[model samples]
Target: MIIVYHNPRCRKSRETLDLVQQSGETFEIIEYLKTPLDTSGLKALLNKLKMEPAALVRTGEALWKEKYRGKDLTDGQILAAMEAHPILMERPVVVKGDRAILGRPPEKVLELL
Candidate 1:
């Protein structure tokens, strides 16, 4: 089974979802904007992604820049920020079992499939 942390508003996310659907594999989509992940959930996701909390953040988002930029935040602080503002989380995070990948180019998700 696969899980996709998706934001339908994002084109890349939509494209990634299309690819996932075409693959005909059992998958689930979590709309992070509507149903945000808690701190522990974020931690588990980061563990699967093999990434630091900061790496999973969408730093370019206005919410992040306005509220969290240049503050020298700890890992916990970063996760808190993402929990407080789901927009700060990166889109189209595709996970399968113990591993995960960000679908930056959409095609990158193919590697996981």
Candidate 2:
């Protein structure tokens, strides 16, 4: 099954959702902001994305800049931070089977479909 970690307030996330809907393929939407992922879940998502935990973070977010920027954090620490503050996570992460992509350009989500 396909799944997308979405934030309705984010334009890119909304666009990604629209693209998924337009594809006519059924997918689960995870409103990550309201229901933040746990550390294990974030780790699993990183594994699915085939990326380091840092790669999945929105480093520009004020929370990240204020609390985590330039900090020597391990992968586990970063994942923990994201679990504690979902806003630090990047948007529109689309997952299908064992693969996932960070839908930054929104078009990147097509790779999974």
Q: Cα deviation of 14 in candidate 1 (Å)?
A: 0.2
- Tell me the spans in candidate 1 whose CA falls farther than 4 Å from its real position: none
Error of 2 at 70 (Å): 1.0
lDDT of 1 by residue, 60-96 (tens): 9988888889999999999999999999999889999
lDDT tens readout by residue for model 2, 30-99: 9999989999999899899889999999999999999999989999899999999999999989999899
Clashing pairs in 2: none
Q: Model 2 residue 41 lDDT?
A: 93
Locate the minimum summed-lDDT window of 10 residues in model 2. Answer: 104-113
TM-score against truth, every candidate: 0.97, 0.97
The top-ranked prediction according to lDDT is 1
